[model samples]
Target chain A: MRHRARRKVNQFILHCILLLGGALMVAPFVWMVLSSFKPSLEVISINFSFFPRRWTLANYIRVFREVSLGRAYINSLLVASCVTLSVLFSATAAGYLFSKLRFRGRDQLFILTLASVMIPPHIVLVPLYTLMNRLQWINTYQGLMFPFLMSAFGIFLMRQFIRGIPNDLVEAARIDGASDFRIYWSVILPLVRSALAVLGILTFLWNYDEFLWPLVVVHDNRMMTIPLILGHFTQAEAKFPGESMAACTLVVVPVLVVYAFFQTQFVKGISMTGLKG
Target chain B: MVAKRRVFNTYIILVASIVFIYYVLVCVWPFAFNLYLSFRKTDLLTEDKFIGLGNFRFLWKDPIFWRSLRNNIFYLAMMVPLGIVTSLFAAALIYRTSGIMRKVYTALYFAPVVTSMAAASLIWQLLYYPKIGLFARILSSLFRLDPNSLTFLQNPTTALLCIIIMDVWKDSGLRTVIFLAGMDEIPDSIFESARIEGASEWRQFFSLTVPLLRPQLIFVGAIYSINAIRLFVPVYMMTGNPPGGPANSTKVLAIQMYQEAFYGLRFGYGATISMVIFALLVGLVILELRSFEQRWEY
Candidate 1:
């Protein structure tokens, strides 16, 4: 009975600590949401209150009116979707070839791909910008979407997943005279559905959150993505904290909703991505 | 049979060629071009003149370059250990709990990671607003510090630290989850045996858990260090009037590179700075790998 009581006390202490930590983790987001609802004057005022004195939609209305936020949203969706689909197609094809096909210089090429992962985007920023300029692709979707069409990380991930698939299955398909493309499409693709989903979601998220490339490549307000618009909103129009918070809320809500629905898959994908130790 | 073999070979060659061409154009060519530009005096539109080591000499003489490098080191020093320890502690606590509570806590912590950095930085800037900000209000109430006087981002002494603290808060959730996953991988039998031997929770943690968590710790350290070295968005967004300002206190290498290349239109100088960043990251990665090797067998 005494031991049971000790365990209960320990659990209570753990609960208190975790609850506090959880609150700390979530408070900024809550504050962001609440401050968005507060009147503009109240948001920047000295009076501290968790609850808004008089809630308003003025900020949201102002955000839509003043900024190209709607266009930015559409741009973000288009870029993310295109990049995700392109990465999936390229990564899976390359991954299947690397994992299943026997070819000359395959290992060396794979190593080269892996080495490219270590090259930070900043390192190549100047040349890439110049290349985009030369191609007349600046301020264009093609420039924004081209560099990220496939990533070393995506190829590595797909390769790892594809390698895990049984050789017997591929052999059986081959015995029936299935073409390489047919085998890849019908047999291999379905088997790696979970990996595809994870890669697709991750690719989309990364592209959506991308800032620097978009900031550099797209000078046109109409071509700006969500992060770029948020940067502009904060830097240029941060005087109105309420409207800025509302803009933030808009920028964050879609990702948050996606995360909510796919929390488990998201967590699993993050862990499996080798990003975590 | 010949036709079939030809088709198979064609498919392989076609797919392989696509991957090769894409990577060469996007990755390989840009890297080579950056290297070449680093050695030349050019601003993309100007006549390219080969002036080997000139850019490096310029970088060597630039005090701002050194300051940015120092600031990056400071960020790395503060963020890595603090992030790891706090997240590890949180992970341990969460690992002890089970059911819906764990999921709720995990989701709450991870919310910030999913939020775009621009949005996160903007929200944090509001929080750190001197007079009316939440932080100022809390600190003033707790320690009687003048809330109106505490300009966290404006004051050079506190600016970088404020950003570090925000980064820690934003990142600890992901770190916590990673640590929890690592902890979960440890066999329960060892813990049960340790408990049966009358070992306290702390003893089991130190003796069994910490050693086992070395890989995770090293990995988290390396990643966070890489992130710290390349820190940009917060500095860009949070420093208000001038992006990396209040006398350039928050200036980092990545931000410096951006300013030099895009804003200053000195592509060669920017490429040199990027090379410096690359060298620094490679050195850190090597150090992390060495430590990882020395500590763990598997």
Candidate 2:
């Protein structure tokens, strides 16, 4: 009984500590969200408060007016969607083929793709930009989506997931006179739906949060993505903490909401890929 | 299977050809171009002139380049281990929670991970503002210092450390999840046995849980280190008007590369930095994997 009480106390202390740390982890964004509603004067005042002194949408109004975050949101959405769709298509086909179809040098090709994942995006930034310029893709949506069209990790992930299906399933499908693409589309796709979701979310988030490449490629405000515009404000509008926090709120709140909605999937997929986030 | 091999053969060829073409265009071609550009002197204006080892020699002696490289190594050293320790603590504590408390704690911790670094940096910059900043005010009162003079991102000494702190805060959630997943994979019976044997919880965690989580520790360490080397967005967003400021205190390889190629229009020099980063990335990954194989055999 004494020992059980001691363990309980220990567990209680641990919980208290974790709760404090968790609060610290979340406080900045919460503060940012709140401060977004502050007028410029209170935002720059000598005292800090979680609650704005006076409720106002002027900060958000400024961000919307000056930055055109609406266009950036659509741009981010379009780029993320296109990249995610392409990665899924390319990874799905490559994965299915590498796992199920026996071709000459198939293992070698898959290994080559696998090896590319080791190269982080930083290494290719300089050359990829020049290549985009050469192809006249700069400031175009194609520029934003081109390099990410096929994900090496996505291919590896899909192959790993697809390889788990029983060979007899594929053989059965083939015996039923299913076309190669048909088996891939109907039989294989449904089975790996969860992997697709995970990969799609992971890819979408990574591409969605991309800052450097877009900062390099997109010169037009119309071409600005969420991160790009947030970066723009940071560089250009550093004086206005109100507008900056409002921009931060606008960019981060939606992601946080989607993340809250898909909490388990987000954690599982992000922890699995250890991607962007 | 053999009878229908012809049909499979045709389909595979088509798909493989397309994938192979993409691989060449995106990965192999650009990678080769990066290497090729490193050897040439062309700033996108003049005609290309092969420089042989000129760029590498200049990079070897560039003080700013050396500073950036030193900063990167410093970042890798500080960020990864501190992050892992925090993660271990957070994850261990989290694993103790049950039911809805677990979900709430997890969500609370993970809110930062979902936020983009760009946005997070801006939020953190606000908190780090010398006067009237949330943390600055709180810390000033706690330390009996003036809020107006509290220099976090402004001071040369504290800039990189401040960035690392924010990063560790943002990234710990993801690392915590990874560690928690690893802990879940461990059998509860191990801890039970430790308890039955009169081992304390601390002893059990140290002896059993941590050792059992060796694979995850190494994995998270490597990932964090890789992420650390490519640290740009926060630094870029946080330090403006030359990107790496406060006397280049927080200048890192990625930022240096960006400034060189994009800002300075030194394409050759920038490619040289990329090559250096590529080398470091591959070398570090190889080193980590090798250590994983050889160092932790117990």
Candidate 3:
């Protein structure tokens, strides 16, 4: 009975500590959402209040009115979706070929592909911009979407997941006169659905939050993605903290929604990436 | 059968070729061009001239370049270890718990990781607002500091540190989840035996948990360091009027590279800075791989 009480005390202490940490972790976001609803004068006022005295939709309304946020949302959605789909198809195909097919120089090719992961995007920024310029793709969706169509990490991830699939399944399909392409589409792709989903989520989030490339390539306001638009909003109109918070909330809402619905998959995906290292 | 095999090989080749072409155009070609441009005197507008190491020489003496490098190193030193320690603590606490509580805590922590850096920076900027900010109000009232005098982002001495704090806050959730996953992989029997042998929780944690969690630690450490070295968004978003202001105190290598290339129109010089970043990251990655390889052999 004494030992049970001691354990309970310990657990209580742990909970206290964790809850404090959790509050610290969550405070900024709560503050963001709350501040978004606060009137503009109150947002930047010296006297900090946790909750707004008077709530208003003025900030959000201003966000929509002053900026091309609606267009930017559509732009972000289009780019993220296209990039995700392209990555899935290319990664799955390449993953299938690397894991199941035999060919000359295949190992070398796979190593080359894997090594590209080390080449950070900044290294290629200048030349890629120049290339985009030369190709007349600057300020175009193609420029924003082209370079990230497939990623080395995606290919490697798909390959790792695909290799786990039983060889007999592919063999059985082959024996049934299903061509390699058909086997890939009909057999391999479905079996690695979880990995595909993981890759899809990761790819979409990455493309959606991408800032530097779009900042450089797409100078036109209409072509701006969410991150770029938010960046501009913060940089240009930082005086209006309420509206900036509203814009920030708008930018974060979609990702938070996805995260809420797919928390397990999200955690699993992170673990898989971490464990791969 | 021979014809069928040939057709299959062709299909594979075709698919592989498409990926290869994309990689080459996007990755290889750009990289090769970056390397070439790093040695040339051209802004993509003028006729190209061979400047052979001129850009490097300029960067060698540039005070801002040195300052940016120092800031990046400072950020890495502060962020990497602090991030790992805080996340490890959070993970250790959460790892002992289960059920809905675990889910709630994990999600709460991870909320920031999913938020875009732009949004995270904006939110943090408001939090660090001088007199009106929540933190300023709390700090001043609790510690009896003057709230009206406090300026977090505008003050050069505290600006980078403020950014680092926000970064650690933003990133620790993901690190915590990763650490929790690592902790979960440790077999329960090991802990049971440690307890049977009369080891305290602290003793078990240090002796068993720490050593076993080395790979995850290394991973989190390396990734955090890499991210810190490439720090851009927060500094870009949160800093003063010109960004990286209060006298260029918050300027990092990645930001400097961007400014020099795009805004300054010094493509060759920017490429040179990028190569420096590239070299540093590759060195870190290689070291990480080597350590991991050694562990695998053991």
Candidate 4:
């Protein structure tokens, strides 16, 4: 009876601790969301309450009205979608080729791609900007989308994944006289759908959060992405605290939603990708 | 049959060509240009003149460049171990728990990893507000310290430290999740045998768990080290761009490169700093890969 009582107490303590940690982890996001709805005065008030006494959608309204917040959203979505699609297609094709095709210097070429991961983007930022300038692609869609079209990491990941698919399956497709493209499109893509899912999420996430390149390339406010806009907002006075919070909240929500929807894949992707690197 | 063969070769060539060109354009060409630029002497308005190893010599003499390099190393030194150990502990704690609670705690820890650094840093900048900030409030309540007396980010003593702490807070979940996955791979039989031999929890953890998790430790360490070197956002957003307050204590190599390139428009000088960063990263990568090979055998 005493042991049972002790066990019950231990369980309660564990639950309390874990729950508290969960609350702590989630508090900032909750705060960001909640504070976005509060009036500007209430946001910075020392006696600020957790829940707003007067909930208003005015901050969101103001963000949309004053800042190019809506335009930034569309810009992020368009740029990220294009980049993600391009990355998916090129990476999948290249990964398939590297994995299956009989090629000259395949291993050496792969190592060359692997080496690209080490060259920090900052190393090439100036030259890339120069290149873009020369091409007259600055502030253009192609300019914004050009550098991100093929990810070495994505190609490497797809190679690892395609290597796991049984060779006999590809052989079977070939026997049916299915061409390489057909096999990749119909047979291989379906089989490696999980890898595609992970890659898609990562590509979207990175492009969505990309700041410096966009900040540099994009001159017009209409072309600015959410992170770039947020930087602009920060540079502006900190007086519009509510609008700032709302804008931050807007920049964050899509990632949160995607992450929530695909938490398992997201976790798996991060861990597996880390191991690969 | 002839048509099919023709089609296959065409497809293969098409893909190969596209991949090769894209690789060269995006990855290879940029580095090549960076290499070229780094060797030249050029300002914004002048034509770049080839000056072999002169830019590197200039970098060698630059005090600010060296200071930034030193600061980055200091930041990495503080961040890497704290990130690794705290995450490992957090993962262990979560792994020890059972049922749905595990998922709940794991999700909470991972929340920060998914959020944008811009948003998080912005929120934290508010939290770091000197007098009315959460840090000040907590310190004042617990230790009888004055809330208004603290100057956190503006002070050299605490600015870098604050950045490191914020980084750990924002990213430890990723490390924890990684460690948890590593720990999950340890077969139950090993722990069962340890228990049968009357091993204490400490013994089991130290002897069985730590040894088993060597590969993961190396992986997490290497990854976090690379990430620490690229620590841009927290320093940039939280400390502000120039890192130019009381002292430029928080200026890192990436930020320096950025300023040199974009702000100063000395593309050649910026490329030089970038090459320096690349060399430092390469040095770290060599160390990491060696550790990888050693741990790989186990």
Candidate 5:
């Protein structure tokens, strides 16, 4: 009985430690949200407040009113959605082949795909820009979305997931006289829905936050993504820190909402990707 | 089985072609062009000149290139191990805890990962303010430190270090989750046996966990190294895009490449620098992956 009580006390201490750590980890974000609401002068004031003195929606209103934030938001949403859909389409089709098919040179081709991941995007940045320019894609949606539409990581992830499915199920589908594409769409796709979800969310998040490629490829402000737009304001470093803060908040909020909704799966996928790599 | 094999062969070939073309265009073709570009001299308005590796010769002699390369190494040195240690510590603590607390802690650690790079960069910009930001105010209050006069970003000596510090904080959480997942996978039976043998927690951790988690450690290390080397956003934000502030103290290789490609409009020279970065990353990745494969005995 005494030992049980001791164990309970130990568990309580551990829980308390975890809760405190969690709060400390989350404090910056909490601070960001609070600071966004605080008046601009109060934001940089040495006398910081955990809670704001005067809570207002002024910053957000300013974001929409002052900057071209709405257009950037729409651009980010459109590009991210397109990238996610296309990555899914390509990766799923390839994954199905790699796992279920036995074509010649499949292993050689898969190795080739894997090799590309090691070549950092920066290495290809210049050449890709040149290519995009030649295609008259510079400062266009196609320039922003085309190269990223097929991701090595997404393909790798889907391949791993598909590899785990039983061979018998695929054989059963074939025995039923289903066409290969039909089996892929109706059968394989449903089987790997979880992987697709993981890939989609991950791709969406990455494309939404992508800055460098877009910065290089798209010079047109009218076509700017949120990160690129927010980047311009921050880079300008004008006296109006309020509007920049507003823009930053505008860029952050939607992703946070998506994260909140799909926190578990997204995190699981991210964590898994890290371990796998 | 024969029919299935025939069907599989056709499908695999079809898939292979698409993936092959993608790899060729996105990965191989551009890389070849990057190499080709590096050897030539080209401005945006002029025709590219084939100088047979003139850019390499110039880069080898360029003072700024060498300085930026050194600064990049310094940044990586500070960022990588600090990030690894902090993350491992956080992961260990979380692993020691239970249920609801675990979920809460995980999400908190992951918040920065979910946040956009631009947004995080801006937040850190404010946080590093010499007079009004949290770091400065704390220093001033506690030790009478003259934090009000110092602007880390504007000062060349402090700019790179400041960015390194922020990168560690933002990136450590993701590393922690990766380490935590690896730690969770270690069989409890092994630890239990160690405990039964009268091993202390520290001894058990150092003796068993560290060695057993080699593959995970290598994976995290390699990925972080690659990502850290590609550091662009914070530098772009903090140092006003040219990076290397206060007479070019913080200018890393990637920033230099960006300047060459986009700002200077020396497309060929920019491509050359990009290729150098590519070669370095590829070498490191190959070494790490080989070791990871060898260590992954399970």
Candidate 6:
């Protein structure tokens, strides 16, 4: 009875600590969304409240009118979708070759590609930006999508996932006179649908949040993605706390809503990023 | 038949080479070009003039470059161990628990990582709004000091620390999840045996669990160090009005590189700064890849 009581106390302590940390982890996001809905004055009022004293869409309306928030949103959607599709294609095709096909210097080529993940865009942005300038691609959709067209992590994840499919399936398809392209299209693609989903979701989230590249290449407001447009809040932070909150909410809520629907896959994809070989 | 197979094999190889060709264009070529640009003088509008080590010599004396480099080092120093160890501890605790509770805790922790970092930083900026913000309100009452005087982000001494703390919040979830997955790979039987030996829970963890988690810890360290060195969005978003301001306290390698290259139009000088990051990252990536390959053997 004494041991059981001690165990119960320890468990309770653990619960208290984890729950406290969990609240801290979740509070800012909740605060942002709630505070955005609050009347502009209430957000920065001396008496702080978690919920809106009187909810309003004034902040959102103000932001959309002053800043090109809607255009930025559409730009984000376009760039993210295009980049995600391109990354998926690049990753899946490379993954198929790395896992399923044999070619000269294949392993070395893969290691080279994988190394690209470590090479942050900042390092390459100058030269690439200059090149884009020469090509007259700056502030264009092509410019925004160019640097992000390939993802090394996507390739690596797809390779790891694709490696698990039984070789007999590929060979059997070959015996049935299904061409290599057909095997990849039918057999490998179907088998790796879950991996593709994970990569797609992850790719979309990452590309949408990408700030530095967009900030550099996009000199015009019309070309701005969500992050580049968030630069608006910085202009007069002290004057408009509610506007900043609303912009943040606009940037964050959709991603969270999507994550809510695909929480398990997002978790698996995120956790696997480090742990997967 | 063999000739036909050769043709088919070429088609497959051609398909795979698409990424390779694009990789060369986007990644490889620019890396080489950046290196070359580091040694030359041009903003791409002017005629490219070769100037050997001119950029580096200037960067060597540039106090801001040193400051940027120092800040990047400080970021690596503070963020890495705090992120890794705390996440490891958090993961270990979560691992001990069971069922729906585990999923809920993880999802909540990971919520920030999925949310837009730009947005997250903005939210944090509000929370640091000296007078009416949460930090000021709490710290004021607890310490019996004026909340108006806090000025956390504006105060140069505290700015970098604030960003690093917020980063720890944003990122610890990722590290924790990674560590959680690593812990899952560790067999319960191993702990069971340790328990049978009358080992304390702490002893079992310190002895068996920690040592086994060495690769994950190192991998997370190297990976995040590369990330922290290239820190931009958080610093930019958090520090308002001429970012890296209030004495340029929060300026990091990537921010410096951006300002120099894009705004200042000192293309060669900017490339030199960025090349520093590239070299540092390559070393970290090598370290990460070493552990990464070792993970397969494990």
- Which one is best on DockQ? 2
Candidate order by decreasing DockQ = 2, 5, 6, 3, 1, 4
Regions of model 2 farther than 4 Å from truth: A236-238, A272-277, B1-8, B292-298
How close is chain B to the truth by TM-score, in each candidate? Answer: 0.93, 0.94, 0.94, 0.92, 0.92, 0.91
Question: lDDT per residue, candidate 1, B49-86, as tens digits?
Answer: 89999999988899999999999999999999899889
Question: Residue by residue across A205-238, what tens digits does model 5's lDDT show?
Answer: 8889888899889888789998888777666553
TM-score of 4: 0.94
Q: List model 2 lDDT by residue over B67-179, tens digit each.
A: 99989999989999899999899898899888999999999988888789899988888788766677788887899887767778888988999999999998888889989
- Candidate 3 error regions (>4 Å): A236-238, B1-8, B296-298
Per residue, candidate 6 scores C-alpha lDDT tens digits across A39-151 of 87888788777899888999999998899999999999999999999888778887888887876677888988887776656689987887788999999999998988988
Rate residue B287 of model 2 by lDDT: 80
Residue B143 CA displacement from its true place in model 3, Å: 1.4
What digit string (tens of lDDT, one per residue) describes model 2 on residues A41-71? Answer: 6876766567987899998888888888999
Q: Show model 4 residue runs off by greater than 4 Å.
A: A1-7, A45-54, B1-8, B244-246, B295-298
Per-residue lDDT of B185-214 in model 3, one digit per residue for the tens?
889999998899999999998888888889
Could you give candidate 5's per-residue lDDT for residues B81-146 as a string of tens digits? 888888887888888876776877887778788888888888777767666677677678789878
- DockQ per model, Cα: 0.59, 0.65, 0.62, 0.51, 0.63, 0.62
For model 3, the docking class works out as medium
The top-ranked prediction according to lDDT is 3
The models' CA-based lDDT, in order, is 0.85, 0.85, 0.86, 0.80, 0.79, 0.84
Error of 6 at A51 (Å): 4.1
Off by over 4 Å in 6: A47-51, B1-10, B290-298
How would you encode candidate 1's per-residue C-alpha lDDT over A1-277 as one tens digit per residue?
Answer: 9999999999999999888888888888889999999988888776678889999999999999999999999999999999999899888988888998877777878887876766756568888888899999999999999889888888888888888888888888988999889988998899989988988987888899888888889999999999888887556544788999999999888789989999988887787674522
lDDT value, residue B168 of candidate 1: 93
Residue-level error in angstroms, candidate 6, position B84: 1.6
Cα error of candidate 4 at position B33, Å: 1.7
User: What is the per-residue lDDT of model 4 for residues A1-277, given as tens digits with 9 covering 90 to 100?
Assistant: 9999998897788778767766877777787888889897777667747788899999999988888988888898999999999988878888888888765566777787778888745557887888898999998888888888888889989988888888888888888989888988998889888888878888988888887788778999888888878876554425777787888898887778877777778888887776675
Interface RMSD, every prediction, one decimal place:
3.1, 2.3, 2.7, 3.4, 2.3, 2.8
Residue A175, candidate 3: C-alpha displacement in angstroms: 1.7
